[model samples]
Target: MIGLNHYLIISGLLFAIGLMGVVRRKNLLMLFFSTEIMLNAANIALAAAGHFYNDLSGQMFAFFVIAIAASEVAVGLGLLILIYKKNGTLDLDDLATMKG
Candidate 1:
């Protein structure tokens, strides 16, 4: 039967993938996507722990994480759009070289 261990393993794997993306990606949009993936992994682990413990705290925290992720996406996307409009590109390296 599936258990907490299984969910935890999946979450770990997802978090690792997201971490790799965050480390290796250069584009702003992809970095945001990677962060979202990491947040979702945390949510999965939290929800699984709550279920296994038969307590509501972990679930409640997971909900909070979800809300935070939503807000991040909203603000990050708006900023990304503005950045793209001003620079015409989302490459971090390119942006870093530009003079203010």
Candidate 2:
């Protein structure tokens, strides 16, 4: 039967993959996606722990996290759109040269 350990292992793998993407990807969109993946991994772990412990705190925290993630995505996408409009590209390496 699946247990907390299984959930935790899956969460760890997801978080690791997300971390790698965030570290190695050069595209701004991919970086945002990676961050979302990491956030989802945290949500999964929190929900799993809440279930295992029969407590509400972890689940509540996960709900708050989801809300925060939603807001972050909205703001981040807005910024990305603005940046792409100004730079005509979403490549992180190219964006590094942008100056005021």
Candidate 3:
């Protein structure tokens, strides 16, 4: 039967993929997506552990994480849009070289 270990393994794999994306991606949007993936992976692990322990705290923390991710996306996207409009590109290297 599926258990916490199985869920944890899946979560770990997803987090690793997200980490790799964060390391390898160069586009601003892709970086945001990678961070979201990482957050979701953490949520999965937290929810699974909470279920295993029959406790609400981990699940509650996961909910908070989701809320934070939502806010982050809202603000991050706004900044990205402004940056793209000002710079005309979302490439990390290009953005890095930008100066006032």
Candidate 3, superposed: residue stretches over 4 Å from native: 98-100
lDDT values for all models? 0.95, 0.96, 0.96
> How do the residues 9-70 of candidate 1 rate in per-residue lDDT, one tens digit apiece?
99999999999999999999999999999999999999999999999999999999999999
Model 2: how far is 25 from its true place, Å? Answer: 0.9
Predicted structure 2: lDDT: 0.96
Which residue runs does candidate 2 get wrong by more than 4 Å?
Answer: 98-100
Higher-ranked by lDDT: 1 or 3: 3
Sequence-dependent TM-score of model 3: 0.94
lDDT of 2 by residue, 12-51 (tens): 9999999999999999999999999999999999999999
* Full candidate order by lDDT, most accurate first: 3, 2, 1
| Candidate 1 vs candidate 2, lDDT winner | 2
For candidate 2, the TM-score is 0.94
Reference-based TM-score of each model: 0.92, 0.94, 0.94
RMSD of 1: 1.8
